[model samples]
Target: MKNILQEVFETLRDFLSVNSPEQSHMLTVYANLDQANPLNRKERPAWLIELKNTFDNLSEEQKNALMTFDGASLTWNGIEEQIISTLEQHEAKGRSVVVFTDLSDTVVIDLPLPVKTGVYYGIPQVKHMLSQLHRYGQYLVVLFSEREHRTVFVDVPTLVSEGTLQSSLGEGIFLRPGGNKTRTQASERRNLDTERRMLREAAGEINDYFMDEPLFDRIVFGGNLKIAHGVKNNLHHAVAEQLVSIEPIPFDATDEQLRETVSILADEYEAVHDLALIQELILRGETCGRAASGMDEVMDALQNGQVRKLYLPYPMDADDFDTLLIEAVLENVEVELVHGIAAETLREMGGVGAALYYVIR
Candidate 1:
């Protein structure tokens, strides 16, 4: 039996395409193949063989028509030459050429004469990369005479501020934007300051209703960028050192981008929720250890269903851990395994940590 790694190398070397200019850009042949090997040689035989065979069995027509090149080593000069030559030869022969490559390192391509050039890659390197491709009436391709092909850029500002507001009803609270509104005169300053205070107060009132013990899993502030920022800040202050996260709801963010962001936040929340529950459990154990007279108090709390969530440290003595876990299950308490708390702490402590809860009530 041939070694799977060697088989894959041979397969790629054989079936790989490098016939067209576009396909040349796709090839990203690596010299240090060991780095790309994701699995142990012994355990990965089946996978290696399957992968090797999949590429090895390509149709002859596909193989012959395909073009391949190495992104890892192909120089900029080589890229230009290959693309230009391929275009000239194919165009003169009365055939259009298209390229394909799995690995993308080729930056751009310029066609000769009347031929058109288009780059298809994961994403472009333009600064302030848009979350989604914009849909407009017609695609514009404005050319500049600058020989250097200067990159275009856009400005994006990050929001960072802190302050608090309270509602007249007492339970509601809000946080307004921090820092001066602008470097203008007294009238403008007064107006901005007053607006900030008002926004904070409104946010405070909304948050007040949420501060009751055993509040809901999360309180999300979405809509109106400025107002959302204020709400996030106020909630952070009100929650203090607990946990919270501020997610900016972009006016232009698409459904897909929003969905991806939500998914990421959910994963983060689960992690934080687990860590906080575990930290509390550790604290309970420490408190029990330090107590002069009564471990019975801690036991009583556990027995009476006072523990809302339980955090079990990783790599515990299996037998003891199972026993405790079973007992907690019987009591209907939630359990989690703590990994790292830093990121979760940041999230939940603000809205980041806010996604998870410890209530401590």
Candidate 2:
């Protein structure tokens, strides 16, 4: 609603001209009232509560001229009296005042009117007020009765859209429209979730899967809410601890939102779980005349200093592997030593040899 009001104001300001039906400040006021009551609802006739601070600039005669049934007078004050009276009436109604003139020597009061919208009568006044407001470096406010029920306060120089601010105030969940590949993607997530659930429910399969694995890094379950939760619970029960983090990807999530969620999940998994997986190839254990073994086969890669990173047990003495560590450092390898509760739990799930970050390219 506030946004619609701002759009109207912007349109009015951008295209106001002599040919335009809305002219003269007084006419603008009437137009604003009509605009506020666009539907011409007889019951809700819009009222313009004009607050006038008539100083000596307006003689008693001119001041009287302003009182000709323009609208309901919210409050009127003598120049001698402080503007606080008008401010009070405005605050009572939760509305902001649109100061007509951009008086150069404007004063700032801590009156409760937090949001301000200021309007100069026309371009000359607008330019002058803008300059004067700039000199004072104070927030200027003016009110626009956009619709009968809505009033928007916009700062002159800043030209901030009140509606935009309101919209941005809350965390908005924008559901993206489904894409051509959405069904396929959703189906895959469902299948992966089902697989994890089945493995966990069948404890024998779960144990068999992990029995001979050297280490496992991270287990990611992606699916809808129900399947995701099922996989998560099953993995927890199977491993006697949480083995996977359940990331429920919404079917209608934007690419950017999905990317952000995936990044966050990856970071959490890396911090808490080891990205290593151990798989015992019972059916094809001896392949290419080599028996499956951990660390020993990869030892040459570790020695040649080709290892980019070493995920070692937290409690393992660095001194015992200092030579390999130095070689790794020389080869610019990152050695992450997994420790504490994460070490104990993730090791059972498959410890330090985990994928930290994945790059699509």
lDDT of each: 0.34, 0.33
Candidates' TM-scores? 0.30, 0.21
lDDT of 1 by residue, 163-234 (tens): 222235242222333575664676666756865765566545555544542312333333354555554565
Off by over 4 Å in 2: 1-171, 174-275, 278-300, 305-309, 338-361
Where does candidate 2 have its weakest 10-residue lDDT segment?
Answer: 140-149
Candidate 2 lDDT, 1-361, residue by residue in tens: 2222233234334333222222222211111122233342354422223222223345555444333323433222432233433333332321222332112122121111222232223222222111122210111111111111111222321232222112211322112233546467677677566555343443333334433332322233333444334434554354534244445544444535444554555445444444232222111223322222234433455554344345555555323343343333334444455445545643554333322222121
lDDT value for candidate 1? 0.34
Clashing pairs counted in every model = 37, 19
